[model samples]
Target: MKVGVISDTHGLLRPEALAALEGCALIVHAGDIGKPEVLEALAALAPLRVVRGNNDLALLWAQGLPDVDRFEVQGWQVLLVHDLADVPAHLDQGVQWVITGHSHKPLIERREGCLYLNPGSAGPRRFSLPVTLALIEVGADALVPEIVPLLAANPLKATSR
Candidate 1:
């Protein structure tokens, strides 16, 4: 199974980001989704699970979003949140992956038996950070993660590919 992971869209859902996530089995959004349309766009692609970011709190429509979410993907337990620092001190022992996004920097690492992944900012470019997202492939025994970088989307020619 393949899972598409994205975060910090802020409001814009780049064409590049959507193109990278095509054909995924599931999608995880770590938050800072500035507008509801972002979720609508992702949901159109696949099953999606998302958490609320700190910035999302000011918006009435996002108020119902959860601060944290947990579920299983291809038998791998996963925790979804926006800020790594806000993760609870106690987590389910079965959780094998912690997915977060807040700093807008991409990260993929493993420590003490759990994998930590951040899909980076796919929205407005910040500073010099490259826009990116991650794809997770679930195999019979282990999970494979890959970071995909998105170049600026060309609206006029975005669909030719």
Candidate 2:
């Protein structure tokens, strides 16, 4: 199964992000999805799972949203949330992948056979962080991840001056 992981979309969903997420069986929005339209747009592309972030509290629609989410994909346990720091300790549910976004920095790390992924800020450009997202192929056994930067994914943009 192909899964697209994205976060910190503070109301902006760029075409580059959409294009990169194409063909994904599921899309995980970690948090900071500024508007309902952003969710709608992602839902249009694929089945979407989302969590509420700090910035999302003001919106009425986010009042009932959960702070954390858990899912099983391709026999691997996946946990989704906005901030990694909020992940509970000492309570184990066999989680294999921890997907969270808050710092606006793309990251991929593996420890003790579990993967920690942050797709970064796919929304409006933030500070100096690159606009990026992640694509993961969860097969019968292995989980392969690819971090795709918006600039490289945007086909219309020129790479050279």
Candidate 3:
């Protein structure tokens, strides 16, 4: 199963991001969506799972939207959260991956026995950071994820000398 991971959009959705997420079975929004339309747009692509971030507190989320959620996909347990600090110490239910987005920096790390992923800020650029997103593919026995950066669709050209 292919899962698209994104976060910290802050209301700007790029067509590149949408294209990268096409054909994904599920889309995970880490937070800071900025508006309901963001989710609506993603829902058009695939089933979406979301967590309310600090910036999203003012928005209305579905009932029982918790700080963390455990999702089982293809027999692998994946944990979804907005903040890494909120991670539970023990995984009694068996978690293979921990997905979170808060710092707006894309990350793919395998710590201990689990994977930690952050799709970064795919919306308006923050500081000097590049816009990026991630795709996670869970095979029957293993999980593979890739972080991809979104480049400007049009690059500036140099003036004639």
Candidate 4:
């Protein structure tokens, strides 16, 4: 299964971001989503799962969104949260992945038996950070992740686990 992971889209859903997410089996938004239209646009692409970020707390449309979401995909337990600091202290033992956003920094790392991924900011540019998102290929045996840069000048590259 191919899963698209995106975060920190603070109102601006760049056309490049939507293009990169095309063909994904599922889309996960880690939040800081500035508006409801963004959700509508993403859901149009694929099934979407999202967690509300701190910024979303003030939005009436985001009131019903959860701060954390847990699910299993291809037998891998996944936990989604907007901020790493808010991750529950006692996580379920089987959770294999923790997806988060908020710092506008793209990252992929494995620690304590779980893979941590942040797709950076797909909204407005932040500092010099590249606009990016992630694509996760889930197979029966392993999960391969690739970070895709949205800027034309950066080119596309794959980062594996």
Candidate 5:
């Protein structure tokens, strides 16, 4: 299963970001969505799993969003949260992957037995940070991750994984 992971859109869903997410079987948004239309746009692409961000707390449209979420995808146990700091001190043993946003820095790492991923900020450029998202290929035996940069020199073209 191919899953597109994105976060911190902050209301700007760049065409490049959307294009990078194409062909994904599922989409996960970590937070700071900025507007209802962002969710609408993402949902239109594929089944979406999302959590509310700190910035979304004051917005009425985001009131119903959960602070965190946990579920199974392609037989993998996954946990989603907007900020890593808020993650429970005792994470569930069954969770093999932890997805988080807020810092807008793309990351993929493994610690203990769990994989931690942050798809970064696909939104407006923040300082000198690269605008990016991520893709995860879940298979029967392993999970593969790829980071896609949205504002590369070519723009809209994703690096081949």
Candidate 6:
């Protein structure tokens, strides 16, 4: 299964981001979603699983925010969390893939037989960092995670004042 992963969209959901995610079997938003409409937009494309970010108010997003989520896709046990620090406590949960977002920097690495992925920040540009996301391909035995750089959503030039 192909799942589109994104996070830190501080209210801006670029057309390019949406276009890049089209036709994915599922979409996972790690956090910092500026508005509920962000989830709504993604749901229109496919089934969505989202976690509450540090900036997201539970009351404001009572219907959408989830602290932690665990699900199986294509035979891979996937765990979703907003912060990486919260991972160690749950590391023993038997999840093959752990996904999180907070720093807005895309990362893909395998440690101790588990895959860790951060789709980066797909929202407004954070400093000079490039807007990014991720694509996860789950197979019968292993999970392949790719850090997808959002070329069209470069915030460096757009945010220059």
Alpha-carbon TM-score of each model against the true structure = 0.91, 0.91, 0.88, 0.93, 0.93, 0.88
What are the per-residue Cα lDDT tens digits for candidate 5 across 1-161?
A: 89999999999999998898999999999999999999999999999999999999999999999999999988888999999898777788888889999999888888677888899899989988999998988886688888888877432222211
lDDT of 4 by residue, 80-161 (tens): 9999998877778898889999989988888786888898889899899989998899887677888888885454444444
- Candidate 6's error at 140, in angstroms? 1.0
- The lDDT of each candidate is 0.87, 0.85, 0.82, 0.89, 0.89, 0.82
Q: Give the runs in model 4 whose Cα sits over 4 Å from its true position.
A: 153-161
User: What is the lDDT, from 0 to 100, of the residue 139 in candidate 3?
Assistant: 83
Residue 124 of model 4 has an lDDT of 91
Task: Give the residue spans of candidate 2 off by over 4 A.
Answer: 153-161
Better of 3 and 4 by TM-score: 4
lDDT over C-alpha atoms for residue 136 of model 6 = 70
Model 1 C-alpha lDDT per residue in residues 1-161, reported as the tens digit of each score: 98899999999999989998999989999999999999999999999999989889999999999999999887888999999998777777988889999999988887677888888888899999988888888875788887788884421111000
**TM-score, predicted candidate 6 vs. hidden true structure:** 0.88
Model 2 whole-model lDDT (C-alpha atoms): 0.85
Using lDDT as the yardstick, the better of models 4 and 6 is 4
Task: For candidate 6, write residues 10-81 as lDDT tens digits.
Answer: 888988789889879999999888888998999999999998888886546645567889898887778999
TM-score of model 5 relative to the true fold?
0.93
Cα lDDT tens digits, model 3, 54-122, are 788876653345667788888888898888887787754688888898898888887777888888898
What does the lDDT read for residue 146 in candidate 4? 80
Tens digits of per-residue lDDT for model 2, 1-161: 88999999999999989999999999999999999999999999999899989899899988888899998898988888899898776336688888999999888887676788888889888898788988888887778877789875432211100
Clashes of each: 0, 0, 0, 0, 0, 0
